[model samples]
Target chain A: MADWVDACATDDIEEEDVIRFDHGSRTFIIVRDHEDNYYCTDGLCTHEEVHLSDGLVVEATIECPKHSSIFDCTNGEVETPPACENLHTYPTKVENGRVFVEI
Target chain B: MPRDYDLLGADAKSAVANGLVTEDWYRTHLDRKTMKALMKRADQPAIWDTVVLFGSMIAFAGAAIALMPSWWSVPFWLSYGVLYGSAMDSRWHECGHGTAFKTRWMNRAVYQVACFCMIRDPHCWKFSHARHHSDTVIVGRDPEVAIMRPVVVVRMAANLVGLTDMWDGLKRMIRHTGGRILPDEADYMDPVFFAKTIRTARVWIVIYAATLAAALLLQSWIPVLLIGLPRLYGCWHMVLCGWLQHGGLADNVLDHRLNSRTVYLNPISRFIYWNMNYHVEHHMFPLVPYNKLPDLHEACKFDFPAPNTSFFDAYTEMLPALWRQRKDPDFHIRRQLPDTANPYHDGPARAAA
Candidate 1:
């Protein structure tokens, strides 16, 4: 059973930016790509559990700010290491002026 | 009876019991926008530096070989040695972080070259250094702690010319060529890189053997001097710079301000060192590119210890402290932070957060 939760306003995240979103005990990030499409993924890097919200999003990839591990923002697949695990990507949809993620 | 630094020994267990394993060291607060800008990767600066590094090496080596049998060739070989031995260390570091270039493969290529030049095993050192950043100088966990407590004078002295490091590195290479992950290395490194580490070792064996064969067959010191010997002859600068990093510094601490040093260096040394004289800033923010470290230092200097302005100041502060530690392993020089800076420890403010 998936529940769609409102993350934030579409304007809240600028182009090529990520913002942290917390629901209950779990944390995820709402990422806005260069094309204004919004995506959602686990908020922490799988490598060392550092917050991925602190990471840099370039093109379609998000790089871990600590160790420079890279991951694709869309499907959450790791593009580089010391991180061998893929990020868990959530389904995202923009509703009116707000962004909603299926969790 | 001083502290032990063995990674798998009793000190390691004590470090874990004491909560020094993977600690969240203090980070000076920088807003998202500023941090993002500082962490942004660029290819141009590294590209330019790499071009000059290789270009000068080529020019010097060419001149040295052409002017062989003359004392005039000594200067050329010396210059080439520094470029090969010392400069490659910084390259190995920055590229290992994958922050030297925006392109992934570019970083990998340079990292491989620098690792070879520095006589370091790539995958093994990559994991070791990652642990280094994580633990800094924690006695039992960090493998890259330079000049560990109760420092061995002979080891440090021999490392000045890259003697012990190269010798130990050769041994490791041969061990890895046996297709076995070292027992200590297996402690932290993921097994995914095992095959690559072995393959790299095999490749290195072939290259070194070829170089040796060339020198033997040609009846000349040229090939050996150009290839295998620069690492030994030119490693002085690397060891010099590396010693000041955590020498006489606190161990088992979560604060890099306590463990790392920031020194002022000359233009040529800075160029060769890739501005790693701003080492505290690099440890605090490991992802920041080497080119942007000076700026990071400027932004964060207020909340940190003052920089050492000369090698005299650095060595004078470090050597005596290290000497004292020879007898009293607990003795270390603690730098005072400015009043305006936030304490990087779990003080009242951090406890509240």
Candidate 2:
């Protein structure tokens, strides 16, 4: 059985922005792209464990605040150096003005 | 031999014990909104500047090559060198921080170009600079400390022509190409990036080898002139500005006010240096973009020592201090802050006067 947890209201995240969603023991970063599409990835930066939610969401990537290593919001693939590993992405869905992430 | 200046040396353990590593330094207070505004990234200014800089480099190189075998070529080469070797340093620095452009790819592209021009490995210097910001001027921690006290006059003189740094960079690149990470680099850098660092070094080696081959095939100095040799001649301005950054300032201090210097340079210098003349403010607020630095300086100047009126004024103060420090390693410029500013920590003994 898959767990789909309601992270936040879709309106809570503006276009091309990210918000940290803490659901019980799991933490996820929910991002809304410029087209209003949603994505879910591990909340912390793979480089230094800094919260990716605190970083900048530019274009389709999230730039880590600490070292500026960028990760693709779509697939959580690392697009830069200093961070070699790809982020674990979760399936995301929006229903009735709410964002849900399947973890 | 015990190299006390090495970041991974035994002194590094002492620095950690003394609470220097990763500790927060003193910062001037700015409202959150103001900070947010300053930290905002933009692409327009950086795009415009990059085009101008690269365009100028092309123009100068073209002129130099066209005028070759004539004395008229000298000025063109000189102009090319300053733009490539000297100005690229600031671009390398700002782009390394990833604050130069709003787009990540743009920043990365410029960083690679500037790194090659300056003969620095982007992967290595990136982490090194991050450590620099984390621990500025803290002896045994800051790898970028330009002057190790009881100043080595010979080394300093060599650096005036970029000899020391260029030689060091080439040697390190060669070592890195062999897939051998220095013990000191391994100390601060994460192990996972080591393989990538090695790969990057290999790529850089190939590019340099190709450049050399081009020069050999052409039987002209033009190829090396366009690539490696400029680092020696055009580097004077870079060395000049770099020395002023922390030359006569306090060392092993947590307060940037006590360690970093801020100078007012001419418009041309500011453009080339990317407003890093506001060095103290940049050190304190590393997230702020270069374009916003002047405004940030305006906001924070009340809490800082007055900016050195001009480069000449700064060098005048710094030269004498360096001369004195040759005999007294404890010697440093004690900048007087305005009354509104908070007093520096460990005040009495560290004050210059």
Candidate 3:
């Protein structure tokens, strides 16, 4: 069981904002949804390698910046073409106003 | 008189022989009227396009030789890197569409010559490029888009690690043409291949090999610069132009028209590349000669695909916008959705019939 690594402060990302955080060989996109829930998913589009952090954060979904493939930030399901695979999500927790994600 | 009915049949047959048009296309697009028009335009380069191509290549080649002395003997590589490589992408592009000549053999002949001179295999390119036109920027199935993805990735990665021209080419060719991308077990349908593929590959190898051998015998770095460096640069330019013109943009529906692209209007970009930046018009009517693209784009601005906001604007933002466009992917073959299921998703239009 990997322990949560404190990724960023709640203030690090605003609602409708996505940022890239590298964890080993894998990269994760930390997106703050409209409801202020912080979700983490694979940072790269599965179909193509465009970074998820660079996408448009719309409500609960993040649209990839390159080809507009949508991904659910909540569970990482692919919502469009080009990308057929679901993005992998990391368990996220907020403690003491700081965001932490389990790699 | 009467437009040579036998010649039309022969031309269509030849186009089929070269894999320029599928049987269905022959039946659908090449009717008597269309065939007559296609013949009228065949094998004869539009005076304007020919002048632009030849003049651009010569001027650029001369400038490159003066500037990069090592590139003198094979200056075509440098000029091609600029003029033909980028702008004139549609010269061979037209050949792929089988509109370069009324006679299929003549078109194939011109394409082969152009491909060899340009160090590209028109036949091989046609196999992939034709699919590109048919499929558009479909991520997995479209080979051209698939081929370009890694390069786009690396370019984005450029901030972290620098990319040389050769490294870029290697990455692209490996993904696109290299057998690694092939699915297990070949799906063989048509047994015959266009002469442009294998023949062009062989000639390219021979010429390049002989050039290398001579360079080695003479013990001069000139060969490395002439044949090698420009190819590296030329191929990179080719891939970039091809990639940006369609791949980076959101895919356009088959019917609504695709967005045309324009780059920095460097003289090199224009003269050498043959105004292919007017891509929307080119794709809309593939048979329209390249020389006529600009006028067409300008005249029919409302009908053609919208030009990108600005390639420079996109450049400044870098790959983010391009990457963002991924979610809204578009395919070339426009279907009415639920009427006739997208052939791109369902599979080839004709399933081994």
Best by lDDT: 1
Error of 3 at A70 (Å): 41
lDDT of 2 at B174: 91
DockQ of each: 0.65, 0.22, 0.01
Residue B289 in candidate 2 has what lDDT?
A: 90
Ranking by lDDT: 1, 2, 3
lDDT of 1 by residue, B52-83 (tens): 99999999999999999899999999999999
Model 3: DockQ score:
0.01
lDDT computed for candidate 1: 0.88
**All models: lDDT?**
0.88, 0.84, 0.51
lDDT of 2 at B324: 82
Q: Which runs in model 3 stand beyond 4 Å of their true positions?
A: A1-103, B1-80, B100-106, B117-119, B146-152, B155-189, B194-200, B235-240, B251-268, B313-319, B323-353
Once fitted onto the true fold, the runs of candidate 1 whose alpha carbons sit more than 4 angstroms away are: B346-353
Which one wins by TM-score: 1 or 3?
A: 1
Residue A76 C-alpha lDDT in model 3:
91
lDDT of 1 at B66: 96
Query: Residue by residue across B1-353, what tens digits does model 2's lDDT show?
Result: 12378876776877787766643567787864566578779999999999989899999999999999799999999999988888999999999988999877899899999998887878778888877876787778888988888877888999988999999889888999998998878866777778877888898889889889999999998999998889898988888999999998887677888898999999988888888999998888776899999999999988999989998999999999998888788888888889999877642223432
Q: Best by DockQ, which number?
A: 1
Find the 10 residues in a row with the least total lDDT in model 3 chain B: B182-191
TM-score, every prediction: 0.96, 0.83, 0.49
lDDT of 2 by residue, A14-93 (tens): 77778889878867799888788899999987765767775667667887755677899899999875677899999989
